[model samples]
Structures are given as structure tokens and as C-alpha cells.
Target: MKIISPCRVHMGLIDMNGSVGRIDGGIGATLDYPNCEIVGKESNEIEIEFSSSISNKTAEEDLKALYNRMYTSANNILNKIGQTGISLKLKEVIPAHTGLGSGTQVSLSTGKLTSSIYGYNLDAYSIAQLTGRGGTSGIGVSGFEYGGFIVDGGHTFGRNAEKIDYKPSSASKNVKTAPLLFRHNFDWDVVLTIPKIPVEEQVADKKEVDIFKKFCPVPEIDVNRFCRLVLMKMMPAIIENNMKSFGECINEIQGLGFKGAEVQLQKSTLKNLLIHLQNISYSGLSSFGPTIYSLGDKKEIIEYSNEFFDREGLEGDIIISKGNNTGYKLI
Candidate 1:
């Protein structure tokens, strides 16, 4: 089976620091940028190949570890499913690091493909239970399921997917599930800044927020809050075409994310870049470090970026795209 999944962006993400139980905690998340892609191929033998503008030129020290990320990620999935005997293949256009959710996309995509290899007899969440890919940020996993402007309710605890607990299994009753997956329309457009450097490191990944190990979102944000922020605020802005309010909401989300102080936004050369471009509307840095964005400037953000990059003598790539209201696909 050849499965492809798109990457997802968290406009505003709040790490719980593992405060709530497996089912209870305050949840804070927002769509940062637009998306990423995950492409997978199930093979007879375990072989992995990856290519990006920077893959061939990663830092010498990071080379070995990078290879392991690609290799071990595959081995780990195949091995966990008793498919260690089989090898899987994956390819991506999103470069490693660079403030893009490359790693999450890669791992969850691998998990999805591995599950598909199991003939869908197993669900992605089950694989997640084994691999821990969608513990907090299941949006990427949801994106893998079906790309779109989504309000992903990251998983809550469940009993091995066995319905024995749903109701007393009187006289050997049958339990089945048809989990309804939903994706909403998001109207915002975003400008993606592909910085020159390849394999940009994540500033916050180093701090390692294991908050999920301690807390859950049952206490904080839930479907209702998600609906308000996403539907009431985010969706209306996107639909009504309110760019400024949309921009402000995105900015507000980022501010909330920094409250823990664990999500670091180390300064980049873009400091002056952001200052100079501040006059223009719709833009901010995604995640942490590298790839500063000028969101929702569809008409001519590309041309503006070129002129600014030329003026600053900084090389960058401009991706004029909107929220992909669908998931990943392969050509």
C-alpha cells in the first residue's frame, strides 16, 4: 500500500507540562503555518531513502543522527507490528527541521503507512499507542488521515478499543466502532518562508516538554473551546475574509503559547526582516526559529518576499499557499 499524509501546523500550541491526567489537562493549540507532506511506500524489505534540498548538506555532526531518524523511524514501526521482516519506503519535500513539523510528519506518516501495510486491520491510533506519535499534537496524524483545515480532538484514553467497558457485555455482546472524523473549512491564506539553511534545528525540542506524561486536556480546552476558537473565531474570520482579525488571532495564539516559557522563540536574522516587513500585513514566525512567515498575503507576498530578501541579502524561498483543507496525497 502506498499512503501519503500531509503535515499540519499548530497556529498556537500550549504544552501541558504533563499536568492533567491521561484525560484531564488544559489544552492550548493553534495553527501556526499551513502544512507539510508525508509519503510512504510499503516494501518487501526494509529500505528507506529521503531527499530534500538540505539532506545532502546536513551538518557533519547531525548527519549520523539524521540518518537514524529516517532509518530507525522505519525500523521501529515495522518492528512493533511484527512486520520487522518487511521494509518500508518514504519520501518528502519538506526539509528537515526549519520550524516545520518535519519529524512529526515523518513519524506519523510512517505509522500510518505501517498500519496500512497491516491491511487497515489496525487503526492509526493503535499504532500511535505503540509509537506515541499523536499523544498531544494529533493534528498531524489527523492530517495524515485526511488533510484539511481541521479541528483535531487529540485522543483521550480508551480501553484497547474494546467496547467491553462501554456497557456491560451481557451474554457476549458485540461491540464495534465507527469513529466519525470531521474536517472543517478554514479560509485563511499563509505565506511560507523557506529559509536558506537546510535541516534547521528546533529551538524548543531541546527543552523536551513531557507535560502530556502528567496531564490531559479534559480540564483545559475541549471540543467546545475548540469550536469557539476554531469555528467561532478562526472559521468566521476565514469565511468572512477578515484578514486583520485573523492575523490578530494568530498572534494572540502565539503569545499564549509562550506563557509556559518553555516554547522558546530565539532571535533570528529575520529580526530586522520582520521589522522591515512589519509595514506589510499578515506574517509571523512559525513554531520556533527559522522560517518566519508573512501569513495570508496571497496577492503578491511572493514578489514582496523576493524584494525584501534581495534588500537584506538573505536568500529565501516563497511558498504562496493557503490552509490545505485536505490531507496528504501522492502523485
Candidate 2:
């Protein structure tokens, strides 16, 4: 069995305050380019291999982490079904820790393939639950299940709630995938610029936890404004295919609520790049990103991103992608 899953761009987290009884609401869209593809078959013993397509270009640390996730995810599903051993091959991958939600995609894809190979049918949510993903954001899980523009309702907050504190998905394991409130086929062009940065600047593991601890419980007023923008402005623009309004919302989101804090933590070069892109079109940093995305004018955005990278003597990937209306495919 083979599974191919699309990657996603997490626009932002909404309602970090959780004052209104929910927390960790998310808005994002699935992307067509830079996806995860894996094939699995029954084997006497567990095994994993990455195709030359990925092995040649992927970083050593990223390859190690991806290998571990595949091994662990396969084991989790195998244990669940009272089965063991599968030969897995990774044909392609989304780069990790660039604010593109690569971890969730890797885990879910591995789990799903393992379950299918063992004749144990499992849905994306079930795989997510078994593999402990979608703790804080539903975009990755939902993106794997049903693609396009998505808005998740988030988890119940306060004492004895689905989530009691503000945390990223990696740190909020075992939390159920949030309820998906809205989904639409997002047709706008998406330009992604992933700038190369040092490992220390890539936020993950303990750094992500500490960042959440230090800058959470964002002001209630900011959360309220964030909600209004999503509900009134962003959603409407998508339904109407208004790129201008949608881009405006993306630009505004960068300076509001939890997203504002996330942007504050970025390096000066990334900050300047975001400002430069905003001047050209509607742009925002995806998650805790060195990955900046702009909506509309794909040609102009890609050209400028290349120029910016050249001027700064930085290196990375620039991709032109569109929303994936269909989720993962099986063959």
C-alpha cells in the first residue's frame, strides 16, 4: 500500500487566552507541493528506507528525526493491531521544523500505511489519536483527512477540560483532534519561501515548550480581535474568492494575539523579509517560521524571494503551490 499526503501552512492559532471556554483554534490550508509519500508492505521484520529523492537532499538531523517518527509510528500501529513487522520506504518528504507541520504529516502517513498493510482499517483521526498528534492544531490532521482551507473549533479549556494550558501540538500529545468547523476549496496561489537558518534558530522540542510557557495566555482583547478577523473577514473572503481581503487578513494576523508573539521571536532577517513581502502582497509567517508565505502574484513573490535570498546570501527553497482540495491519496 502507498499513501501520499499533502503538507499544510498553519496560518495562526486563535484564542490562546481560552477565556471563552475554548483554546487552540486554528486556521490553515493544505498545500499541493512538498508532500509526504510512503509505501509499505508486510515483512518478517520492521524495516525503513528513504528513496534517493529524499536522502540526497535532506539534512542529516532531519533524516534522523524522520526515521525515528516512521519507526515509532509503525510500531504504535502494529502494536495496536496485534501485528508486527513492515517494510516501509519513504519516497518524498516535507522539510521539518520550518513551520510547515512536517511532524504530523510524517507520523500520520506512517501510521496509516502500517495499519493498511496489516489489514486494520484506520482513519486519519484514529491514526492521529493512536500516534498522539493534533494536540494543539487540527490543520495537520484535518489536512491529511480532508484538504483545502480549514478552520478547527479547538478544544475545551479551563480545569478538567480537553486542554488546560497553552501548548504546541508536539507538547500537547494525546489531545483529541479539534472539531473542524469550516472547510472550503481555497483557490488562491500560495508562494512559500523557506529560508535556511541555523539549527538553534529552529524552534522545537524544549525551545518550543519554553516559548509557550513564557508567552501564553495572550491578552483577551487580542484574542477577540483575532476571532473577529477570521470569522468575518477571512472566511468571507475565501467563500467569495476575494484574494485581496484574504491577503489583508493574513497580513493583519501577523500582528495579533499569539501570532504577534511568535513573530516577535523571529530573527531580524526573517522579520525584514516578511515586511518586504507584505509590501508586495498579503504575506504572513507560517507558525514559528523561517517559512514566509504570500498570497496572489506567484511570479512576483517568487522573484522577490529569490532576490531577497541572494541579497542576504541565504539559501533555501521557494515553492509555488495551490490548495489541495482532496486530501491524501492511496494506491
Candidate 3:
């Protein structure tokens, strides 16, 4: 069985960590874009073969840890339940360390497919919980379960709520991750530009989150101000096909996210490349590091990017991606 999970770019992030007793913010939207693919092939012994293009960028120990974790997690989940020994080979395409959630995608897909192949009958939510790959925010898990244009409820997941686990639970039994509420409502098209640069995640970990709680323990406001930027500004604009709102928000969020996560950002040729694009784009920094997503009309984006490249000599691989509605799925 094989599973492929697409990646996403967050438009605007709001610090909703106040509710969860943490400091991580809530994201406005997750645009479907580049995705990571994983394949699970059952084998006789307890052996797993992992091959991924992003492995070139993944730290050796981390890579081993990821594989070991998945293998052990899967074995524990399935074998203990049914004694089914399964083998997996991870086939990856999405670039890693670019803030594309490559690791989460791979892990989510692997878990989903493994469950399906063994006929364990695990639902999508259960699949996400079983993997522990999308904790950065439930949106990734939500995206894994659903697809395009979604807002995973915050504060709930961060509260150590058993309901949010990928595995099935009583609290979240009938939850569907897809856009069932608005099946044909939203069309999201995003252009993903990945410059071969290192990017790191910029968020407070568990420990840091604790420190944040200590420093800033305030009441939870409606966050309407921030949501205004997303819903009143970006959402309506997207529905109406407005470019200005999209660009403004996109550019602004990128810059803010960059400033928030500079220390862990891996080195890349992005800043220099951005110069060529600046004149023509509302580009901003993407998750963790080196992937910059530019939001604009399809024509304008192409036009400006080409103009910048030709006129200013910018070089890097660019992927023109349409907003993905398919979040995570098994094939």
C-alpha cells in the first residue's frame, strides 16, 4: 500500500497558544501545494527500506530516528493488535527542511497506508494520532485528513486532549478531515518556489512553550483582529479572486515568520534570489526556512518571476503549484 500526502503554506498565523497553555500560534490557512509520498510494502522479517530525495538534506541521525520511530510505531500499533509484521519503503518527492512538512507528510502517509494494507480499519483521525507526525499544528493533521483551505481548531490540540490523536477516539469519532462542509466551496491555488536553501522551523518547543506561558499569561481575546486579516481580508479576497489581499497577507506573513524563526533557519541562497523577485512579487518566507511562496495571479506571478530572472539573473528551481484540495490520501 502507498500513501501520498501533500504539503501546505500557512498564510497568516495568530498566537492562539494562550488557550492551550502554550505560545504557538494558530494558522489562518494551509494552502495545498507540494506533497511527500510514502510506500509501505509488507515483508517477512522486521526490515524497512527507506529512500528519499530529501534524505540528502536530512541529518543522518534524524533520518535514522525517523525511520526507527515509524517502524517501531507501526509495529507496535499493528503487530501488537494483530501480529501483522509489515515492511515499508518511503518514496519521497517533496524537498525537506524547506518548511514543507515533508517529515509529517511521509509519516502520515506511511501510517495511513500501513493501516489500510493490514486491514486494521483505522480511520483518518486515528491514523494521524498513531503517527505523531503532525503535532507542529493540528492543521497538518487536519490537512492530512482533509485537504485545501482549512483551519484546525486550536487550543484543543495543544491541551493534551486525547480527542485530537490520529487514532480513533470517542470525542472525535465522526470527524472528517476533508472539506465536507464546503466540498465545492473554495478553490485555492498556490505557487511554491523552493530555492535550494536550508530552512528551519521557528516555533517554541514544549520547554520553550512552558517559558512562554510563564512570561505572558494573559486572558484570551477573540483574536478577531488577526482573524480579520484572514477571513475579512484574505478569505473573501480569495473567494472573490482578489490578488491584493493575497499578496499583502502573503508578503507580510513571510517576513514575520522569518523574523520569528531565523536562528534555526538553514543557510540558503534565498535572500539573494528574493532581490530579483522583490520588484515583481509579494513573496514572503515560508515555514521554518528556505521555501518562499509568492501569492499573485497566475499570469502576474509567472510574468514577474520571468522578468526578475531575466533582468536580474536569479537562479533556483521554482514549482508553479495550484492550491491543492487533496490534503492526504492513500493510493
Candidate 4:
């Protein structure tokens, strides 16, 4: 069995105030390019192979730890379904820690492949829970399950609730999944500006957790504005396929607390690039980003990025991708 999972661009967190008892509301859309494709078969023991080299930018120990985590998660899931062993070949993978939701896409792909090959009928939601994902935001899982523009209602908040603190998925202990609040098939092309920054400069693990802890419980008014933007502007634009309105709304999202914090922590070069793009297009940072996504004419965005790189004497990967309206599939 083989599974191809689309990657997602996280827009921003809608609310973390927990004032109304829920937190981590998020918005995102799936992209057709930069996907994780896995092929697997039954075997005597757990094994995984990669089609191409894992990113040279990632450290060896970090790569080993990532593979181990995925293997262990898949092993546990397969064991629960009475399957003994499996061999997986990673036909393709998204870049890790680049704010493209690589971990969830890879994990969900592995879980789905294991379940399907062994005759288990596990939905993506169950697979997410079993694989221990979707704790922070449902957008990734929802994109894997239903693809397109997605909004998650997030988790309930309190001292003993499913989630109380703002943390990365790796540190989340809750077994609960964020609920999908809204979805729509988005028909627009996204130009991704992926900067190849040094691993040390990138934010992940402890630094990510610290950022969430320090900046969360953002002011209530900012949360309210995020809510208003999504409910009144973003959703309507998506539903009506109003590209201009959608872009306008997206341009304003980074001002919200969650992505706002990420922006503040980003490297100066990335910060400048984001500002430059904003002058000519609607662009926003993705996750804890060095990746900025712009929605507009594909050719114009590409030409603009190329010009920017030349003018600034900088280099990075630029990709043009369309929205993935359909979820993952078996091939």
C-alpha cells in the first residue's frame, strides 16, 4: 500500500485566550506540492527506507530520532491491529521543521498506510489519536482527512481540561483531537518562499515550547479580532472563492498574537523578506516560519521573488502550488 499526503500552510491561531473555555483555534489550507509519499508492505520486522536523502540541513542525530519516533508510532499501531511487521519506503518527504507540517503529514501517512494494508478501517481522526497528533491544532489532521481550507474549533481549556497550556505537539500530553469547525474547497495557487536557514537559527522543540508558554494567553481583543476576521472575512472569501478578499484577510492575520509572536522571533532576513513581499502581495509567515506563503498570480509572485533574490543577493527555494481540495489517497 502507498499513501500520498498533502502538506499544509498554517495561517494563524485564532484564539488562545481560553476565555470561552476553548483554545488553539486555527486556520490552514493544504497544498498539492511538497507532499509525503510512503510505500509499504508486510515484513518480518519494522523497517523504513527513504527515496532521497533526508535534508542535508538536518543533523544526523535529529534525523535518527525522527525516524525512531515514526517507527515506534507505526509499530504500536500495527501491533494493535494484529499485524506483526512492515517495511516502509518513504517515496517523498517534506522538509522537516520548515513550518510545512511535515511531521504530522509523515506520521498520518504512515499510520494510514499501516492500517489500510492490514485491513483495518481506521479513519484519519482515529489514526491521529493513535499516532499522538492533532493535539495542538486540527488543521493538519483535518487537511489530511478532508483537505482544502480548514478551521479547527480547538480544544477545551481549564486546569484539568484536555489542553491547558500552549505547547508544541511533541510536548502535548493530551490524547484528544481538535474538532474540525469549517472546511471548503479552496481554488487558488500559493507561492511558497522557503528560506534555507541554518538549523540553529530555526525554532523547534524547547524554543518552540518556550515561545508558546511565554506569549500565550494573548490579549482578549486580539483574539476577538482574529475571530472576526475568520468568521466575517476569511470564511466568506473562501466560500465565495473571492481571491482578493481572501488575500486581504490573510494579509491581516499575522497581526494576531500567535503568528505575531512567531514574526517577532523570526530572523532579521526573514522579517525583511516578509515585509518586502507584503508591499507587492499578500504574504504571511507559516508556523514558526522561515517559510512565507503568498496568494496571488503565480507568475507575478515567482518573478517578484526571483527579482528580490537577485536584488538582495540571497537564495532560497521557491515553489508554486495549488490547493489540494481532496484528502490523502491510496495509490
Give me the candidate number with maximum TM-score.
2
Give all TM-scores, in the order shown. Answer: 0.67, 0.97, 0.70, 0.96
lDDT of 4 by residue, 1-331 (tens): 8899999999998887888998887999999989988899888789987655664555777678668767976887887798888898887788887899998998889998988888888888888888888888888999998899999988888888887777777788655778888999978889999977887998998988888889988999989888998999999999888988888887787777787888988877788888878877889998888889998767877887888788777778999988998989898
**Candidate 1 residues 1-331, lDDT tens each?**
5555544454433323213212211221223233333345556766655445445655655545545555655676677666653454443334455555566566555666665666555455554454445444455555555555444433233555322111110111222211323455554656676657533444434233333222223234432343355556765665676767666655544334332221333445565555444456555555443665566455566776788788768776776555555454433
Choose 2 or 3, whichever is better by lDDT. Answer: 2
* Cα lDDT, all candidates: 0.48, 0.90, 0.54, 0.85
> For candidate 1, what is the lDDT?
0.48
Per-residue lDDT of 89 in model 2: 97
> lDDT tens string, model 2, 226-282?
999999999999999999988899999899988998898998999999999999989
TM-score head-to-head 2 vs 3, winner: 2
**What total of clashing residue pairs does each candidate reach?**
26, 0, 16, 0
Kindly give the stretch of ten consecutive residues in candidate 2 with the minimal lDDT sum.
112-121
List the candidate numbers ranked by lDDT, top first. 2, 4, 3, 1
Q: Model 4 — which ten-residue stretch has the worst lDDT?
A: 49-58
Top candidate by lDDT:
2
TM-score (C-alpha) between model 2 and the true structure: 0.97
How would you order the candidates by TM-score, starting with the best? Answer: 2, 4, 3, 1
